[model samples]
Target: SKKYHCTYCSKGFSRPSSLRIHTYSHTGERPFECPEEGCNRKFSVQSNMRRHLRVHRGGRPAR
Candidate 1:
C-alpha cells in the first residue's frame, strides 16, 4: 500500500521523495540535464541522466 498519491494521475508512491520525482512525469519539469557539449538533453530523474552519461563514455544506454 502507498501513502503518497499523485494528483495528476492514477499513481502512488510509498515514499514522499518517490512521489516528488513521479510528479515530474506529469509536470514536465525535468531538473536533471545532460551536460555533454551540444547534446543538451533533459530528464526528470538523476539516475537516468547518469545512465545517459554512459553514452558519452562509449557505452550503450539501458532502456
Candidate 2:
C-alpha cells in the first residue's frame, strides 16, 4: 500500500497512479488543450477545458 498526505488529511492507495492523479492539487500543470481553430488554449485540468469549450460554442462570458 502507498500512503499519501494532504494539507487536511491522509490516505493510502493500492496503486501509485491514484496517488499521482491526486497530487495535481499541488502542481499546477496545464495538460489539456482546446481543439478549436485558432484558439491555442491549454488548461490545468481536463474539466477546465470542458468549461472553456462552452464559451466558444456561443455561451456568454461569465461576467
Candidate 3:
C-alpha cells in the first residue's frame, strides 16, 4: 500500500520522496537539467535526467 498520497492528483507513492517528485508533474517544475552546453533540456526526476545524459555521451539515444 502507498504510504503517501498526492494532494493535487490521484497518484500515490510508497515513499514521501517519491510523492514529492510526483508533485512536480502538477507544478510543472523541472529541477533536473542537462549539463551539456547549449542543451536546455529539463526533467522532473533525476533518473530521467541521468538517462538523458546518455545522449550527450553517445551522440544518440538508446534503442
Candidate 4:
C-alpha cells in the first residue's frame, strides 16, 4: 500500500486525501460545520462533526 506522511506531525496515512484532510488540523482550518439549526460549531474533520451530531441526537458527545 502507498503511504502519505504529514510534514508537521509525522503522522502517516494510507491515502493522500486523508493526509490532505489531516493537514487542516495543523493549519487550524475548519471547513465542516454542524448542520443543526441552532448550532454554530465547526470541525476540522468530518468524523468530529459526526461525533458532535450525537449531541443533537440526545446523546453525549464523544470524549
Candidate 5:
C-alpha cells in the first residue's frame, strides 16, 4: 500500500494527485471561474466551481 502525507495537515492520501489537490486547501488559491454572464464567482478547484454552478442553476444567489 502506498501512503502519502500532506505537509499542511494530518491527512494522508493514496495518490499523488490527491495530495496535490489537498495542498491547495492551505494556499487559498482560486483558479476556477464561472462562465455564466454577470457571474464572477471563483473557486479553488474545478469541483468547487461545479458546486457553485449548481447553486446558480437552482436560481439561488451566489454569496
Candidate 6:
C-alpha cells in the first residue's frame, strides 16, 4: 500500500485523504460538528466526534 507522510508530525497514512485530515491536528481546524441539537461541539477528526457523541448517549467520555 502507498503511504502518505505528514510533514509536520512525521505520521504516516495509507491515503492522502487521511494525511490531509491528520494535518488538522497541527492546524487546529475543527470541521466536524455534533449533529445533536444544541451540543455545539466541534472536532478536527470524525472519530473524535463519534467518541464525543457517547456523552450525549449517557456513556463515559473516551480516554
lDDT per residue (tens digit) for residues 1-63 in model 3: 998999998787999999989899899999998888999999999889888989878856533
lDDT of 6 by residue, 1-63 (tens): 648899998988999989989899899999999988999999998888989889888896644
lDDT of each: 0.89, 0.67, 0.88, 0.88, 0.79, 0.88
lDDT, candidate 6, at 11: 88
**lDDT per residue (tens digit) for residues 1-63 in model 1:** 899999989698899999999999889999988988999999999998989988897786643
Off by over 4 Å in 2: 5-28, 60-63
What's the TM-score of every candidate structure?
0.75, 0.52, 0.77, 0.68, 0.61, 0.66
Model 2 C-alpha lDDT versus the unseen true structure: 0.67
How do these models rank on TM-score, best leading? 3, 1, 4, 6, 5, 2
2-61 in candidate 4: lDDT tens per residue? 488999988999999899898998999999899989899999988889899998887876
- Which ranges of candidate 6 are over 4 A from the true structure? 1-12, 60-63
lDDT of 1 at 38: 94
State the displacement of the C-alpha of residue 22, model 2, in Å, after optimal TM-score superposition: 5.9
Better of 1 and 5 by TM-score: 1
Error of 4 at 13 (Å): 3.0
- Judged by TM-score relative to the true structure, which candidate is superior, 5 or 6? 6
State the TM-score for model 6: 0.66
How does residue 38 of candidate 6 score in lDDT? 100
The worst-scoring run of ten residues by lDDT in candidate 6 lies at: 54-63
Which window of ten consecutive residues has the lowest lDDT sum in model 2?
A: 1-10
- Model 5 segments more than 4 A misplaced: 58-63
Q: Alpha-carbon error at 6 in model 6, in Å?
A: 3.8
